[model samples]
Target: MNALAAELRGILQGPVLVGELLGRHTTWRIGGPAELFVAPRSEQELLAVLHLLAQVGMPWMALGTGSNLLVRDGGYRGAIIHMGALQTMEFRDDGTARVGGGLPVMRLVRQAVRRGLAGIEDLAGIPATVGGAVVMNAGAGEQAMAGVLQGAFLAGAEGMEYWPAARLDLRYRASAVPADRIVAAAILRFSFADAEMLESSVQHRLSARRKAQGVGKPNAGSVFKNPPGQQAWRLIDESGMRGRSVGGAQVSEKHANFIVNRGGARAADVLSLIGEIQETVRGRTGIMLEPEVQVIGEA
Candidate 1:
């Protein structure tokens, strides 16, 4: 492990953390330690790290704020790449914003509102990075990331390149970005709007999100994606699973679609709760609920 860490450190300018606890980096405050954790300072450094990993046949996963992820209790054996350093932000005169994938979605929304841009204000409160948002098609009500994304820069072992939004094949809480690539940056389009009006809309959206999905507990936002025309929260509520618990994991009382950690929760606890919810909902409504939050790493 030390040798691998030293190798990773040798290849990149960013800090390489050995055996860093994944819980500290994730919003859920769960998961065990990562064998090799890195925060690459640039895309070039990231590509270098990738090449090294490929040469050694080591597995890895990209992380963007960790708001929509769950790592198991046993943790991941390979690299965990943190994209927080690539937070460059630039707005064009043609009503488009060129932003880094590591930039927080909330920050983008807030900045857009300040610039009187109207498109992603409804996504103001989602606790995800731009890359994560793009991958998950993250949104609220009827708006989604698919609606605003123009294109993105993706990085792979071969090289970094731009893939238009049309190529992304973004759907509800999912995207077609190949597992081999990572979002490096993105270009999003927005329309001009009154700054005051945009700010007001953002405020309203934040309030609505808090009232509906915010549980004031450690959680990975919505647990399940809304299936077709039906809402996952409605189904869970109708199934009487609200406030249900397994170990330290519990179905949020505020929102049935969310599973919150009361304290000392494990990935197994959450997974068990998710399975129970899916089974109960499927039996009652005949619709199997799919998770919106990603579950990764070992058991």
Candidate 2:
């Protein structure tokens, strides 16, 4: 252990897990371990811990609900700051809702619907956090975080600040949220819609997703971004890579884009399968598939 690790062990007001298994945290349920894992309950505690980490120049990554992430089998050499406990939600009189980074995306969606807030009903079945959703610009159809975000609070080595949605450079499945920074909270502007209409929309979207994506398995959502004028799943299905397996990981028979862990899949297994699919698809169709799932940890 380094000096910084030693110091963090003494200072943080949270559980200090050494060699914590990351597979248990991720939606894919496949990863080795993180050298350290810390969960801070409040923004102040989070900032204080980060300040100490900065002082020591120790590396760290922020983790949300682990929806769109794949950690390597070799594991992360540094620390992981888990935002699971920072879940706080508040609605303002101006028809805006303030949500913490750790709040589940589904929870937020349901709350917004209950309050008759429109714009995020399309996000009904997404299994991530507000921070992760915003960072990745996770969306479907024509709606994304960019469309509803009013502003966000970011925390990083340089410190914290609030920035408007325009500053985020929200593009397709990407955001200007700096790699080193963690999204602490967000202010979302939503229009008041009829409760019945919002509920109907949410249910319809969820039904579509359930039928199309079947998102209950131990798998990262979509493995690759859709190529121009072409859906990735359609391409993969056409390439004849469905039901393919590498180790315990297999391309979901129900959805070509999803790589499911049949039982005890490893990170390397999933990655190898992903590489195989990408290579095969590119070779056949001449269109390179870009992975939407975020691969993290030491190579």
Q: Name the candidate that leads on TM-score.
A: 1
TM-scores, one per candidate:
0.97, 0.96
For all candidates in order, the CA lDDT equals 0.90, 0.88
Best by lDDT: 1
**CA lDDT for candidate 1:** 0.90
* Angstrom error at residue 164, model 1: 1.0
Candidate 2: pairs in clash: none
Query: For residues 147-196, could you state the per-residue lDDT of candidate 1 as single tens digits?
Result: 88999999988889899999999987789998988999999999899999
Candidate 2, run of 10 with poorest lDDT: 1-10
Error of 1 at 236 (Å): 1.2
